[model samples]
Target: MNSDTRTAPLACAPRTPALMVQGTCSNAGKSILAAAFCRIFLQDGLRVAPFKAQNMALNSCVTPDGLEMGRAQAVQAAACRLDPDVRMNPVLLKPCSDVGSQVIVMGRPVGVMRVRQYVDYKPQARDAAFATYDSLAAEHDVMVIEGAGSPAEINLKAHDIVNMAMARHAGARVLLVGDIDRGGVFAALVGTMELLEGWERDHVAGYLLNKFRGDASLLDPALDFMQQRTGRPVLGVVPYLRDLGLPEEDSVTFKEGLPGLRDGVAAEGGSEEPGTGPGSLPDILLDIVLVDLPHISNFTDVDALRGEPDVRLRVARTPADLPAPDGRMPDAVILPGSKNTTGDLRTLRASGMADALARLASDPDGPVVAGICAGLQMLGLCVADPLGLEGGGSEQGLGLLPVRTELAAEKTLRRTTGVHPRSGLPVAGYEIRHGITVAAEGGEGGGTGPGRGGAAFPFLLREDGGPLGWGTHGGRVWGTSLHGVFDADGFRRHFLDGLRTRRGLAPLGRVVASYSLDPALDRLADAVRAAVDMDAIYDMLHLRPGRV
Candidate 1:
């Protein structure tokens, strides 16, 4: 290694206590662990915030002040009972292709670049990240820092701004987390430490073994060996949590299995069956198929819907995954958000999924077709990218709605509250997109009417008296730009009730409570507190028991 690239200790410690959580690999539970620490610190009466100098995720959220950041940081902010601030995650890299990504600095897009180009731009990115970190550290009593990928990536270490480099910059104690569920926990931990430089090794205060499923005592030998080998204490062995009820950070969760479907099936006594059978209750279990787009984003929008007792959610990646001609048709079809509207739309068209969706919407007795954000844009007459914002092109849409969309340079990001005029229920969500959609001129069902029964109507009337979405075919084919529209308990129940009424079944009524993360956060904190040595963690930070 070059002398200039050699790791060095911080010149002075940060006044505010900071703890950094780095992982042995991607999906080693770094984000969740950071969130748990945020909650744990908050419960102990100390002000805490989450920070990640850089994040690479397509799944994102809009802050109350209209800035965009990684969804994981937003969840962590919720754990701290604070609104998400862009400073918490300064640089966000959204991959648009295998070798290129759209770099977002301080929650705003700069430009797209290839891997080598981004590496060249690391100096400026590092400056922005350090500035943001300094500002946040000045305000919060403690900051829980999360790292991207592994610190042992030697090839990228020289330009690294997210892993051990960031830990050293913040003068934070490092907690290296390894996934026991992925096996090779011992080697992964030991190898990571062996790969780190001397100063980086000094920063590592302890080790955390995540997703441990077996007896804790069974790990005594291995834990002892790891501590002796690395000279760091084994702080925790977190249990494998099931149905954690928290939104995932990205699409990696899909690779393991469809998340909501597994829980829904287990809820029904492990039945793989889809719908209600003979002599079943009149409350029909509605099958809702979500089109898994090539660049799907904000998939957590449908998480609330999946938790409903009368809903069965499934992901459809291709035409074959959709309902068969001879098979039972789904009760509803959802086109979720996408990062690349034009690109993903082209893929869907090429894969014949577009044609299948057209057929479903055309069938009078077919399922309700709904779309969100980019999915809403795709359901329109066409999507045009005049400036080549989405790789510079235009594509024909499914023509399910009488609207046309044009990609714009400026993205709309804001928290929105509105009301569903049909059901008179309050609705709230957020908007994060770069598309401007308007009604088609001289087209049938193109007029903006009241949000009520009609061939075409507004989906919602915003609190500011503006229309947010459109619907056609008397609301059978509809879409909205809002991301979390279905999270409202009353509106979600009403929407599901509409599906039930169409199938000649009774509404299940509002038996479930509104969704909240407090219980889940508390449960997670309790688990970590029980399994981990919290006193040692506090002592590492030089913090006493009462408060900061």
Candidate 2:
């Protein structure tokens, strides 16, 4: 079999070129490298897509086809301007509650498998990985794949589906990435090769040194030494850009939330990031408010708003703390996600914020009050949290959206893609929620509807083979168990701009929604590809014809 082989793709026919990012170990920038390369390839005018034959990261996403995958590739897919689907991330291993993993097969949870059970299922996992690779390879012009952890995890190497094993199986050209800033960078690379058998080492064509700081020439001596010892080329060094403002895929990168406002520190003008969006503010100077409850998740939703030139975002610790808003109430109020619904609801009610939220929703100004995930559920009338039921009691929602929600035995975890039927527009997102919210009759029970105490509707409805009035969802002022709804920059720009306009502020007129990030990505990818010795990697791995 020619190296670019995939079990699923062979079942079809493929025509795309493939590349892989191999890491010296975890946090070696493998996912970033893949993302950058996809951008680079797209900049080259190719219909590029990103893929990771297999990945194991705590940061995960659900695919459009309803499969669960790592969030890293999903972020890269956003950069590549492609829909995040199962084919983009074929194999997903999510660490479920604890020792158990909710194994996702082809965009659906197969079952909970323990580590030992997963070990026994390695071959199946790999076969599934190849199947995913094939499915994606058949569609695009270029596919950038990513590897997980060090290629040399000895204990886990036997059953490894990432790194050289998958690369060898996929016949992908390998560009190994090494973190130079990490001490023992040389040993990390050389020792990794020494630890690997001849075939394993062969797939790495070159090595890219990432996160390098200071002068490049000063490190030339060490670079030359690595080249001489391992005979692999040191491609280029990537200088770190502070606050690159990209959405991070894993918790390791969550620290960006701290430096400014996330830690609750006020910036030069009161608070830099307490609520302002990512990068710079939007062009409009509308003051927006967010209900800063206790259990915040999906904080990334407002990250891109920081890039605008004229918007100010603030978090409301209490109703009394709500911004005076240029002598008027806020143009909009956003209810972000929460990890604990019942607990947060209680906190809201006890803190008097719930009453404040209800008053705002009822305000005749008709300001848009947006809620996401648990935030969306909280906008409803009642949250039937079984956790509270079993542990003592339950809490009532603010009744702003007119809906009722309850926790279910099983969680809905997977990628949700395609047009948001309610909006009839392309909205890419995924769902990971413990609670299943069903729109209830809002008549006398204080449920969600225009006439009820609530101001907005709960969810969007689907009009397909599903029912009409109440098929899959309900109305706007909606919430799905989905995260990464803002992954699509266009949708994000539109939504934020709309909210800003509603607040009586001007929009960032025709700002570029699709940022051509490939230039930045290519500078990164070429550096990675240039560092590792391709000829030697292919030779060591026995990936050349007749070796296997």
Candidate 3:
């Protein structure tokens, strides 16, 4: 269609043929491998790329093009040094309710389509999937594709874009990854391979064993026996990187315990580090509770906190599930972003959390309650349902802050800049949401306007304007559409530092922004290499720098 598409032949693909790094199950380290491999290829000075045919998760993100896609694709894009775009992830299915989803095609929210309705939409989804692969393949020398949860899930095999079907369609080689940490790594690997039908089985170029604990020498014999029996290569046996920062796909990987890794207690609690800044913040444990609402998206917001030795965080699913801080009350409670705004609101209310939250917001001495995205919406005075416009019902909010949220008939998403007119934080992260919580009601003049950044004006009303869900008082309660808001330097520490100061604790000097993610990537690659066949991995996949 254009000059770039015309010479698409030069578009880079693995010279020896690209190999996929799919996992036996979810969180089997497939995403890490994708990012790590991209980083490794980038380190080798070659222009590498990443792709994922279909990623189904509430954890979504905005691409540089101002379109919505899954956050994992964003991470992989960062690893490969590419600007995030919806093309790399053309078909994004973000669920709005239990049985419904909002289908995003080519970076735009097309319509609120039903799941059952998508069954016959294959012809459309396949065309977009191939178009995306072709575009990415044309730009780089090597493309690394990440598959969805366990290619072995028998019932989910059809309408499949992440596994064998994708491999065959793209004419790409595949590598299966199984988590040894889950204990039946051998069975999982062999079982998955056994389920593949004919040609689908042939695309698998190799296999990788991931997340082994201590001592690889002990597993050598098992490795030998399996290699011979399965006729697949084991690339590398990787040890787990305890502090890796690759964001997780869902809450299934969540862990709860005393703050940080330590002695005598939690085997996974966390550990003592040098005063992670001023008056020893990372070393001074603070108890935290994360409100586990249904429809939660972008859990990565809390990843850094999870890695912190001083801050103890846990997910609490109900009003009675409140986790106390050490021997005292929780120091803070975070309401992470979610997809179904009105639904999450109703959940809070039905669970009797509505009364608990109202009391907490009114109590000056209660644990500080904070909400992000939909969590932020719940904290408002009122939150209305969007379905009502299409002729449905609505619900009231927790009313912690003066804000109110009204779900418009249309959803909104984009990448934009917001200077903290408020406090000690980093630069703008990114925003992805479907509803707007305002300070008041029915005051918005129009539903659309121009936004400063790549963002569209979805704010129900302007700052001076009043809409059904508008707000007045800010600081104590805050709402933003941005994700990764807490990741910017000084953002988390500065905020945590304030918490310490409130409790009369000294400020944690300088927060550690030098987390050194590159080393983590390299370490993961080395680990993945163990479960893979090294000789074949390099010989078959690695092309010198620019030689596609």
Best by lDDT: 1
Residue 100's C-alpha lDDT in candidate 2?
Answer: 55
TM-score of each: 0.92, 0.66, 0.84
Candidate 3 structure quality by residue, lDDT tens digits, 347-454: 777887767656554455656667777777776656666466322566666655555567776556655554443442334556666566554443222111100112
- Across 1-548, the per-residue lDDT of candidate 2 in tens digits comes to 11221112122222445677887888787787778767655655666688776665445666666556666777788767776777777667655334655566666656667889988887887888887787777776656778888888899888888777777666666677788777677778878877876666555566677887887679888878776777566665666544444556554544333222443222333322234564433323555666775545565666555444444556777877564433456666777776567777778888887777667666656556677778777876677756542133556777665456787656676545555554454555556676777666632236333326433332433323221111111232445554655556666666667765666655655554353344445555455445434445344333332222
Report the lDDT of model 1 for residue 264.
25
Question: Which window of 10 residues has the lowest lDDT sum in candidate 1?
Answer: 445-454
What is candidate 2's local distance difference test score? 0.61
Q: Which of the two, 2 or 3, has more TM-score?
A: 3
User: Root-mean-square deviation of each candidate, in angstroms?
Assistant: 4.3, 8.4, 7.8
In angstroms, the error of model 1 at 459 is: 1.3
After superposing candidate 2, which stretches have Cα over 4 Å from the reference? 1-18, 41-49, 57-68, 75-85, 134-143, 171-173, 181-184, 242-246, 255-300, 312-370, 378-402, 407-435, 440-548
Off by over 4 Å in 1: 1-11, 263-283, 324-326, 445-455
Worst 10 residues of 2 by lDDT: 465-474
Task: Locate the minimum summed-lDDT window of 10 residues in model 3.
Answer: 447-456
Q: After superposition on all CA atoms, how large is the RMSD of candidate 3? A: 7.8
For model 1 the local lDDT of residue 513 reads 42
For candidate 1, write residues 20-122 as lDDT tens digits.
9999999999999999999999999899999999999988988877888999999899999998999999999888777888899988889889999999999
